[model samples]
Target: MIIILLILSVIIGVFLGKYFGKSQSFAKNLLILSAGFLITVCVSEVFPEVYEAEDHNIGIWIIGGVLLQMILESLTKGFEHGHFHHHHEEKNILPIALMAGMFVHAFLEGIPLANITDVTSPYLLGIVFHNLPISFILGTFLLREKNNIFSWFIITLFALASPLGMVFGDYFNPEWQPYFLALVGGIFLHISSVIIFESNKNHKMDWQKLFLVIAGVGLALVNHLFHAHH
Candidate 1:
């Protein structure tokens, strides 16, 4: 059942991303929604439990993970921006580097899913929601570069990356789980924060955009609250 849900979520993410790619406004909205949802997931779902576990030096791992992503982004020259491929002309190394970093990040995220004792469904749902916008962003980039085959392959790989991580995580010792969780959480924070920050229109704040972010967070809160009460 869990495996099925994972596959379904990835499929949903791919299609939604493809659909949203056609509209800038809708894509922006989706990103904001994803941001809110990610923030909520981090705060309400991931943070509390991860902090409590305190199984490993999370702070350090988080910083390390963020640094890793920063380096990767620099190499990729902001491939996450979507629809912009001028950087692609610079070198082939950038795309390969970006994929490596993103793959590692996605796989680590899957590790936590395997660790989830309760609320597995909700967690997977949130992950799917989060990945959809990212998939769209990546897809847009691929389309712009006219690399259809590579784009599809990258998208498919992104979807499966997490599940693969979960498999690896399942074999890891319980004592080391906290460190992994913190690292993955940090990676998520970096990605989601970038999404929100980049999604901002101009340097000025937009109420509608802010609202979408809040809506995303609210969705996660609702799920968290339900879990808490239960």
Candidate 2:
């Protein structure tokens, strides 16, 4: 069901990109909300889980994840955070590097999903919602490039990347779960922190955007509460 939801999000994003290309505000708000949600979940849920592990070296692993994402973004030009800038002349060329980076990032996010001993729904939900804007942004870029077959194929691959990651993650021995979770925590930290920090370029915080952040955090809190009572 999680795999199906992830794929469905990408499909929805592609559909929106094709038909609603002009809806930049919607896309922007979606990115903001999703980023906020991811950040909140990472702090309120994911980080605490990994930190509680017996391994004292988990912090180093999480930092490693952050640094890894930084390198990946160098190739992707920050695609995971909605940085889909492209030159008009270069638009004719496929963004092979960007796609490769996004695939690795997406695949790593699924590693923690395979060993969901506690409060895994938030992780799954966070990634699925997070992927929507990513797919939308990528879909818009691909459609603009005018390669119909290739665009569809790449989007399909992006949709499947997480599910494939889950399959691969299932093969890991249980002992390594903490390292993988901490790594994912770090990845989430970098992505979500970047999104929140870079959300406002004018240096003045937009009230609407702030609300989105609050709403995102509220969502994570609500989910935590709901699960805690049950």
Candidate 3:
């Protein structure tokens, strides 16, 4: 059921982009909102749980995840965020590196899901939220490229990557889940921080972006408080 939701989230995003991909600002706003929710979850939930569970140096894995994401971003060219479009316009060739990076990133995110207790897990919600804008942009990219065979193939793999990771995690050693969570937490941190702090063209802070970010954080906290008591 969770696996299906993950795939459906991507599918929904892709269709949304297909029909309404004109507004770059709106997409960025969504990204900001998602980032705010994501980082709050990480700081408020994931990091604390991992640290509480283990006394050893999980920071190593967290730092490793951050570096891994950096490498992946080099390949993805920031498509995981809002830096989409025109990347392949001139070449019109397949972006194998981008796909590879995206696939691995999504897959890693799902691996930790195998250990999560329920659908309400913040990690689960965070991925579902983050993947929407990503796949939406991918849909827009496909439209720009005329929606060829490669586009379908790309979409399929991207959609399946996280679910497959969850399956893989089901077989993975249970004890190691914390370390992997730490790793993913780091990846989330980097992605969200970059989105929130990366300035606009004039290098000035946009008040609207700031407000949406605050709203995202507030929503996450409210949800957290609600779940804590209920």
Candidate 4:
């Protein structure tokens, strides 16, 4: 069920981006909203879970995740954050580097999902929602470059990257679970924070964007509380 949802989200993202990627504002708004939810879940839930493990070197692993994302972004041109601009539409060939970056990032996201196995786990939710916009942008990029059967084959492979990570995640040493969680948490932080803080030039969010952010944070709180109670 979770694998289906994960694949469906990216497929849906491709559909939306192919048709509606021109509306950059909607994409940005989605990023803001998901960013709000993702960062909150990271701080309020995943971070706590990792720190509870009491690993002295955990902080460095998280930092490594952050750094890893930075490197991936260089390859993706910020596709993971839904920040792909309109200026690059002229190039009509598939970008292999972009696909590679998102593939690895998504793969890493799946690793921690296996550790904290839950249908409504924030880790899973974050990756699913977070992938939406990036996949959307990827679709848009495909639309601009090569909206061919071959392109969708690439998308299908990209869609499977996360679930594949989850499948392989079981092979990881059980003791290392917390470290993986912290690492993915850091990746979530960097992606979502860039979306929120860099959305506006002056860094001032309007009422609507502000509300989207608040709603996302509230969502994380509710999810956190529900898990706590159950």
- Give the local distance difference test score of model 1: 0.68
Q: Write the per-residue lDDT of candidate 3 for residues 1-230, one digit (tens) a residue.
A: 89888999999988888788877776788889999999999998889888986658889888998999999988888888788756656554247987899999999999989987677776788899899989888888775447888888888999999999999999989988888899999999999999998867798778898898999899788877766776
Worst 10 residues of 2 by lDDT: 85-94
Residue clash pairs of candidate 1: 36-216, 36-217, 37-216, 37-217
Off by over 4 Å in 3: 90-94
The pairs that clash in candidate 2 are: none
Per-residue CA lDDT of model 1 for 182-211, tens digit only, reads 676676677678767774456788888788
User: Whose TM-score is greatest here?
Assistant: 3
**lDDT, model 4, position 156:** 83
Model 4: per-residue Cα lDDT over 41-101, one tens digit each: 8998889988999888899888998999999988877777775785365453236776788
Evaluated with lDDT, which candidate comes out highest? 3
TM-score of every candidate = 0.82, 0.91, 0.94, 0.93
TM-score of 1: 0.82
Instruction: Estimate, for each residue in 26-81, the C-alpha lDDT of model 2 and write its tens digit.
Output: 77778888888898788877888887787787899999999999998887777787
Compared with the true structure, model 3 gives a TM-score of 0.94
